[model samples]
Target chain A: MIVAAAKPWEEIMASLHGMHKVLVVGCGGCVAVCLAGGEKEAGIMASTLRMQRKLQGEPVETEEITLTRQCDPEYVRELGKKLEGVDGILSLACGVGVQVIAEHYPNIWVAPALNTKFAGATLEHGSWEERCGLCGDCVLGQTGGICPIIRCAKSLLNGPCGGSQDGKCEVKPNECAWNLIYERMGRLGRLNQLLEVAEAKDWSQGRDGGPRRVVREDVKLDD
Target chain B: MSNRDFAPKIVAFCCYYCAYSAADLAGSLRLQYPPTVRLIEQPCSGKIDIRLLLQAFEAGADGVYVAGCLEGDCHFLQGNIRAKKRVNAAKKILDKIGVGGERLEMFNLSGSMGPRFAAIATEMTERILRLGPSPLSTADKGEEGKAE
Candidate 1:
C-alpha cells in the first residue's frame, strides 16, 4: 500500500483562501490503515480549517465525508450526489485517489491534503519504511522474500554491495537489506537461490516514462 | 458575566475501562471535586481522536484532558499509547494557535484511583481558572450551544 503524510497546514490553508463551502474527503483504504488521511484525519482537518477561518473572521463552512476507497471510480462516483452545494473538495487520499476524484468530477475543484510518499508498511506505531520500488520486477524469490530494491540504499540485485559493512548499510547505519534477505533465506533453507545472477530491472511497467493503465473487457462498465 | 467572573468550561474525556470507573468510585465515595469539569465517557482512549479533543475546545471548552489507563497497562494493549500521541499532537496545534498547549493534557490512572481522579479534576479546573476563559468562549457563547 502507498504511504503518505498530510501536508503542512499553512500550505493547505493558502490553497483554499477564498473558498466558502468546502468538503473534506477521506479515504478508508491504505491511508486509513496508515493513519494519514483517513476519516479521523479528515475530520481534524475540517475542524482546524473551520477554526482557522473563524480566527481570520472569514465565514467558511466545511463538511466531511469518508469514502470506502477513493482510488476506485465506483467509490468516487458515490460522492456525486453529495457534491451538489460544496464549492470545492479537499481529498485526503493518495495521489491516485486525488486524480480519480478529479477525473470523475471535473466540475468540482479538487485539492490533495497529503504528500504521497511511497509504497511501504509500518515498522511500528509511528514509524514506516519503504518496502517496494515497483520496479516492474519481483526478485524476492532470489533475494529470500525481502525486497532489496527498496530496502537497500543501492538496489543491489545479486548480493550486498561494497558499501555494506558488518551486516549494515554503509550509506546509513541501518541493517543491510541483503543481510536480512540472506538470513531469511538461510532460515528457510533457500540460500542456494542467492547464487544465481540477476539482470537489470525493466522500467516499462513502472511510472518512469509515463502513466500505466489496466483494462479488463469482462469487467467493463457497459458489460 | 464580566471577565473576572468568568467560569471556565472544561471537558474531561474519561475512558470507560479506567477513568470512568474511577469517576464512579469517586462519586460513590462522595469525593469533593470541581463542578466545572464535565465528564464524557469513551470506550477507550484510542477512540478519542484528536478531532474530538479540538472540537471540545472549538465548542468553547477552556481546557480538555483525556483520562486513560496507565502506560503499558491499557485494556486494549496500546490504546493509551495512541491517546498520548493524539494529546501531544493536539497540544502542538493549540500552542500554534495561541491557545496555550497547557490547556490540553493526558492523565493516566487505574480504575481504583478515586482520589487520583478527584485530584486531576481539581488540578484541571484550577489550571483553566488561572488561564482565564478561552478566547472562543468569550467571542461566542451561542456557537457552542449550537454544537451541543
Candidate 2:
C-alpha cells in the first residue's frame, strides 16, 4: 500500500491563506489503510485548519468528505456536486488520488495535504516501511522474497556489499537486506543461486520509460 | 485574560472503567470540587481522539483533559497508554499554534481513587483559572477570534 504523511501544518495553512471555503477530501484507499488520510484524519486536519484560520482572524469554511477511492474516476466525480461553493480542495490522499482529482477538475485549485511516501507495508501500528521500489519487474524468486531494489541501500543485485557489517547495513543500524536474504536462502538450501551472474535490470520498465501506462483492454469498456 | 472571579470551563473525557467511577466515588465521598468541569463518559480513553480535544476548546472549553485508567490498568489493555501518547502528540501542536499546550492534559487513576479525582479537578480548575479562558473560545473577549 502507498503510505503518506501529512505535510507540515504551517505549509498547509500557508497554502490555504486567502481561501474562504475549501473541501477536505479523504480517500478510503491506501492512505486510509495507512492511517494518514482517512475520514477521521481528514476531519482532524479540517478542524486544525479552521482553528488556525480563526486565530488569524480569517476563519475558513471547510467541508469534509471521504470517497471510496479517489484514484478512480467514478469516485473522484463525487466531488463535482461538492465543488459548488468550494474555493479550493485540500486532498488527504496519496499523490495519485490528489492528481486524479486535480486532473478531473481543471478549474478548481487542488492541493495535496499529504506527502506520499512509498510503496510499503504496515510494519506495526503507527509504523510503515518501504517494501517495493516499483521497478516494474519482480525478482523475488531470486532474492528470497526480500526487495533488494528498495531494502538494500545500493540496490545491488548480488549484495552483502563491503558496507555490510554484523548483518547490519552501513547506511543505518537496520539489519542488512542482503544478510536477511542470505539467511532465508540458506534456510531454503538455495544459497548457491545468490552467486549466479545477474544481468542489469531493464531500466525502460521503470521511470526511464517516461510515464508508462498499461492498456488492460480486457477490463476496459468500449467508449 | 485575567479576572478575579473568572471560572474556566474544563471538559474532561473520562474512561468508564476508571476515571468515571473515580468521579462517582468522589461524589459518594461528599468531596468538594469545582463545578467548572464537564465530564463526558467514554468506554475507553483510547476513544478520545485529537479532534475531540480540539473541539472542546473550539466550544469554549478553557481546558481539556482525558482521564483514563492507570497505566496497565485500562479496561482495554493499552487504551490508557494510547490516550497518553495521543495527548502528548496533540500537546505539541497546541503549543505550536499558541493555544498553550499546558491547557490540555492526560490524567491516569484507578476506580478506587476518589480523593485523587477530586484533587485533579481542583488542580485543573485552579490551573485553568490562572490561564484564563481558551483564546479559541468565542466568549465576549474571544469574539474577535470567532470561527464562523
Candidate 3:
C-alpha cells in the first residue's frame, strides 16, 4: 500500500497563515492502513492545528472528514457543500488525493497534511519498507517475487551489484533483493532463469513519460 | 509557564510484556521514581507510532519515552526492534522541529529489571526538567510558541 507521513505542526501552521477556518480531509485508502491519514489521523491533525494555533494566539476552527477513497471523484465530490465556508482544505490523503481535490475544486486553497512516502509494505508495525518502484514494466516474473527495481540498491537486473556483501545491501541492513532472488530461484530449480540475459527496460513507461494514464476503453462509458 | 515554575510532564509508553511487568515490580519493591513520569501500557512498544509520540508532545508532554522488551526478547519476536527504529525516526523529526531531540527516548529492559525501570523514570524526568516545558505548552501559557 502507499505509505504516508504527517507534516510537522509548524509547517502546517505556516500554510494556514490567514485561514481562520479549514476542513481536514482524510482518506480511508492505503494511507489509512499505513496509519498516516485516516479518520483518527484527521482528527489528530485538526486537534494539533488548533493547539498550535492557540499557542500562537491565532486559533483556527477546523472540520474533519474521512472519505472512502479520496482518489475517486464521487467521494470528494460529495464534500462540495461542506467546503462552502472553509477558508482552506487540508488533505490528509496521499499526494494524489490533494491533487484530485485541487483539480476538482480549483478555487479552494488546498494543502497536504501527509507526505506520500512510497509503494511499500509494513515490515512490522511502524516500519515500512519500499517494495515496488512502480517502474511500469514489472520484472517480478523473471526475478523471483522480489523487484530488484526498488529493493536492489542500484536496481541491477543481471546480477548482484558489488555493494551487496553477505546478502545485505550496502545502503541498509536489508538483504540484497538479488541475493534473495538467487537463493529462491536456486531452491525452485529455476536458476536457469537468471541466465536469460535481460533486455534494457523501456524508459518510456517510467516517469520519463510525465503524467501517466491508463484508458480502459472496455470499461469506459459512451459520452 | 516559566522554566522556574515548570515541573515538566513526561509520558512513557511501556510494553505490556516487559516494561509493564518491570513497573509492577518497581512498585512491588516500592522503588522511588519521579512523580512526573506517566506510564501508558501498550501491547507492544511497536504500537507506538510517530503520530502517537507527537500527540503526547502536542498534549503538553514535555518528554516522551518508549520502554520495550530487551533487544531480542520481544514477545512478538521483533516488536522492540521496530519500536527502536520508530523512536530513532521520531527523534530526527524532534531534532528538526527544535524540540531538542533529547526530549524523546527509547529504552529496552526485561520484565525482571525493576531497578532499571526506576532508573529510566528518574533519568527521563531529569532530562525533561532541564529542557523545561515543551515549546507548545510554553507558548500556550506564555507569550509565543518560541518554536523551540
Candidate 4:
C-alpha cells in the first residue's frame, strides 16, 4: 500500500485561497489505515480550514467525503453527483488516487493534500516505516522475509555491506535487515539459503518506468 | 458583588459505568459542587470524538474535561484508552493553535469516587479562574495585548 503524509498548512492555504465551495475527499484504503488522510483526518482538515477561513473573513464552505477506494474508477464515479457546485477538490488520497480524480473529472480542479512517501506499514501507533520498494522482484525466499531493498541504506542484495555494526545498520541505529533475516533463517535451519544471492531488481514495474495497469475482463463495469 | 459574579462555564463528558455513576453518586450524596459544569453523558468514552471536544471550546466552554473509567477498567474494554488518545491529540492541537491546552483535561475514576469527582470539578473551576478567561473570550473583550 502507498504511504503518505499531509502537506504543510501554508501550502494548503495557498491552494484554497479563492475557492469558496471545496470538497475534501478522503480515501479509506492504505492512507486511512495509516492514519494519514482518513475520514477522521479529512474532517479535521475541513474544520481547520473552515475556522481559518472564518478568521480571515472569507467564510469558505467546505464539505468532506470519504470513498471506499479512490484508486478505482468505480468508487470515484460515485462522486460525480456530489461534485455539483464544488469549486475544487482537495484529495487526501495518494498521488495515484489524486491523478485518477483529475483524469475522471477533468473540469474540476483537483489538488493533492498528501505527499506520497512509500509502500510501508505502521511500526506502531503513529509510527510508519518503509518495508518494500516494489522493485519488480521478490527475494524474500532466500533472505528470510525482510526486504533489504528498502530497509538497507544501500539496497544490497548479497549481504550487508561494510556498514553493518553490532547487528544494526550503520546508516541508522535500527536493526539491520540482513541481520534479522539471517537470524530468522538460522532459527528455521535454513541458513544454507543465505548462500544463494538475489539478482538485481528490474526497474520496469515501479513508478519510474511508467503507469502500471491491470485488466480484468470478467469484472467489467458494464457487467 | 463583582467578586461573586464570575461563573466559569465547564463541559464534562462522562462515560457510562464509571464516571456517570460517579456523577450520580455525587448527586445522591448531595455534594456541594459548582453547577457550572454541564454534564454530557455518553455510552462510552470512545464515542466522544475529537470534534465534540473542539465544539465544546467553540461553544464558549471555559474548561472541558472527559471523565472515563479507570485505564484498564473500561466497560467496553478499550473505550477509555481510545478516549485518552483523542484527548492527547486534542491537547496537542489546542496547544499548537494557541488555545492553551490546560483548558482541556481527562480524568479516570471508578463509580465509587463521588468525592473525587467533586474535587476535580472544584479544581478545574479554580484553575480556569486563575487563567482568567479563554483567549477567545478575551478576543471578544477587544483587548489586543492579551489576545493570545
Winner by DockQ = 2
lDDT of 1: 0.88
Query: Which regions of candidate 4 deviate over 4 angstroms?
Result: A197-199, A215-223, B1-8, B58-62, B70-78, B126-148
Q: Kindly indicate the candidate among 1 and 4 with the higher lDDT.
A: 1
Residues A1-223, candidate 3: write the lDDT tens digits: 9999988777877887899999999999999999899987887677667665765567688888899999999999977978878999999999999999999999989999888989999889779989999998999999988899998888888989888899999998989999999999999999999999988988689987679999999999899
Badly placed stretches (over 4 Å) of model 1 are A188-192, B16-32, B43-46, B69-81, B109-116, B139-148
| CAPRI class assigned to model 3 | incorrect
Question: What is the per-residue lDDT of model 2 for residues B1-148, given as tens digits with 9 covering 90 to 100?
Answer: 4477687889999999998999999999999999999999999999988888888877778899999999988778999999998899888878877788999999999999999999999999999888877767643355543433
| DockQ pick, better of 1 and 4 | 1
Fnat for every candidate: 0.37, 0.44, 0.19, 0.04
Best by lDDT: 2
lDDT of 2 by residue, A85-136 (tens): 8999999999999899989999999989999999999889889999999998
Error of 4 at A22 (Å): 2.0
Query: Which residue pairs clash within candidate 4?
Result: none
- Candidate 4 residue-wise lDDT, B16-133, digit = tens: 7888899889989999888888999999988888878877876678789999999999999999999998999888766655567899999999999998889888888888777666
TM-score of each: 0.87, 0.95, 0.67, 0.84
Candidate 3 wrong stretches, greater than 4 Å: A1-15, A28-64, A81-85, A92-95, A112-223, B1-4, B143-148
Task: Report how large a share of the reference interface contacts model 1 reproduces.
Answer: 0.37
lDDT of 3 by residue, B1-148 (tens): 5667778789999999999999999999999998898999999999988778877887789999999999989999998989998789778766655565799999999999999999999999888888888877766656443443
Evaluation by DockQ, superior candidate among 2 and 4: 2
Q: lDDT (0-100) at residue A168 of candidate 2? A: 95
Candidate 3 residue A176 C-alpha distance from true site, Å: 15
lDDT of 1 by residue, B1-148 (tens): 5646877788999999999999999999999999989999999998888889999988889999999999988999999999999899999887766677899999999999999999999999989888888766654654555568
- Provide all candidates' interface root-mean-square deviations: 2.4, 2.4, 3.6, 4.0
Candidate 1 clashes: the total is 0
